[model samples]
Target: MPLCHLLQFVTSVVSCSPAELKLDNNGKKEKVKGFNVILKDTILFPEGGGQPDDHGTIEDLPVVRVLRQGAEAVHFISSALEEGREVQLKVDWERRFDHMQQHSGQHLITALADKMFGYKTTSWELGRQRSSIELDTASVKPGEMEALEDAVNNRIRDHVPVNVRLLSIDDPDVEKVRSRGLPDDHAGPIRIIDIEGIDTNMCCGTHVSNLSHLQVIKILGTEKGKKNKTNLIFIAGNRVLKYAEKSYNTEKLLTSLLKTGPDEHVDAVDKLQKTVKRLQKSNLTILRDMAVLIAQNFKSQPARGDFFSLHNKDGDNEFMNIIANEIGFQDTIIFLTVGEEKGAGLFLLAGPENVITELGPRVVELLQGKGAGKNGRFQGKANSLAKRAEVEALLQKHSCRRAAGEE
Candidate 1:
């Protein structure tokens, strides 16, 4: 039987000892305390060759991770089994098969891309949702993407056999195959994946024996990568079905909300976006006019208050600035707030330079905000507007004291 299918193995434990394993999860290095178990033989494939580690059980104890340390496949498990004791190993076939499909699909795409477009895959990733191959070219045209997809799917339908060969470094055939060089601590026979008449490449990742097992390959599309490179995204096997189901559900939801068919959904969304933009333009015009009128009314008041203050729930920093600009701060202190009545928002304070400088930090502390200012104007994001009344009182008290001092 092929080694990949040897999920059930009765092997003696070579060693089992307490150890701390550091693993990079989502760009974060995390330390896991476990026992490193080396078996006489292992079916679990360690993370390498752009493929992830296999998840399985070691004597019914869950193997958290498997890593290749030179020639040894070390298994990390929560508990330890006695050294030299024989134990049964089981592989999570579902996870293993998914990885196989993605890895093999990647090979098919990479090979065809190089053959058809002369775009060599510089690197590839088997992501959780989809896989991507970074092509050395600056861009891939839409027509080329379509043709590549057709070619890969054709190979899948052809039921081409995927053969694995173990060759020594000195073997003449090793020179014929595509290689990216071996690891620094590599040893023993080098494994090569041959896609019948399609291509042969040096790789250590597990693959499906037949191309037909891939079921289908869907080239989702491409995205701009680093300079002179493009990332071609794709999904294969069950992932294609899952993606289709999710997309259909989203379409149905959009259809219900949009009251239109899938074909008209894009047009409907575009029309709504244009309308929103027009309304936003009109709203801005109205806010500017209103800011001027508000200042005029405050100045025309029969008995003007000690300080002027206003809060607009639907306003923003620009609106507050417009109001402050209209109401000059020569002899008046203006406290303008734009946001929710008693929640987070923005605050603007403009008055004498010395007064604003003295009050800016205190206001920021009260509202749990951070801001900077020069001259006389101070503005910032206000996290808590619940203290707006207290801020107004402080401004009024200081204004009163300043007025008395001037008198």
Candidate 2:
């Protein structure tokens, strides 16, 4: 039997080497320094065969990671242990049992998928939340998935015995077992996982002793995979309960917010979205009409000033453009801004081409903004609309200076 098959063991440290391990924190990569210790034997399984490494403790020190290197399992620990020292090794049983359930569940699903539907499992992953098996087929229909789930759960209810068998590499039984091939440095007897009357595959990951231990398996759904393949997502054992609880909580929150029953959530949200769209359209129409009125009123002034300026706190670039178009930029230097009076907003300057070219850069600087101009129209976003009075003074002073020069 493999030492990993045991949950607790007394072992001697063979060697210790200090090393730095790079880990992904969220989306960031970080490096952590630790000691890689090889033990005379280990109860913690190393990462291999598509299953993650087991986490445990050695003499009360945390064993963070384990990896199989040739015939040895290297345990990465937070602190170094003296070589040849005897230590007590204990596996994190909860995590170990979870892996056992998921690994065994995967075997059952893979075996039955091949047997019943002839869907060969090309690859599989034991993910943190859920596990998946990639089938050679392009897709799995809902009906087929339902049937597959039913079949796997039936076997779980059957309480079938799952046995581990060891055989010589050259044994006839070794050839009968399903295998993806052995690692380059594989040694000792071949380890085979046998699901009585169900499957016999060569795997090094831990597994449950009985099908009943899987508790249950839920086929979540299917997702697109590589060319001509489909990935079937699933959750087994306690994960099924976790997923259900999360889904129910989400449904409850939506029901409360939407003020509708769970069944009516979709329709209620759809109606709310349509109402918002309608209101936005109406608001845009009103803003356009108001812009035209403001322009006409400014034009109606009997004694018109060279510069006409207006600011609408709750307006946008389109609103300012509408006002400028209605007033006509031929004669008056129109400085229209739409946004907060003392905060961020947008501004448009339209008049003489020479004036636009000269004043555009100044206006952008005063407004703490960025803008572009062509012909006689300049427009851009403004970050400091509070400085509008200073911009007005500058425009007035420049206009007066130009008029006097013309005279």
The model with the greatest TM-score is: 1
**Candidate 1 per-residue lDDT over residues 108-213, each given as its tens digit:** 9999999898999999999989999999999987699999999999999999999999999999999999977899989899999999999899999989999999
How displaced is residue 159 in candidate 2, in Å?
0.2
- After superposition, the stretches of candidate 1 with alpha carbons farther than 4 Å from their true spots are 5-41, 57-67, 73-90, 341-343, 403-407
- The backbone clash count of each candidate, in order, is 0, 0
TM-score for candidate 2, residues paired by index:
0.74
Candidate 2 stretches greater than 4 Å from native? 1-5, 279-407
Local error of candidate 2 at residue 203 (angstroms): 0.4
Residues 189-290 of candidate 2 have per-residue lDDT tens digits of 999999999999999999988899899999999999999899999999988888899999999999989999999999999999999999999999999899
C-alpha root-mean-square deviation, candidate 1 = 3.2
Judged by lDDT against the true structure, how good is candidate 2?
A: 0.90
- Model 1 vs. true fold: TM: 0.87
RMSD of each: 3.2, 5.6
Per-model TM against the reference: 0.87, 0.74
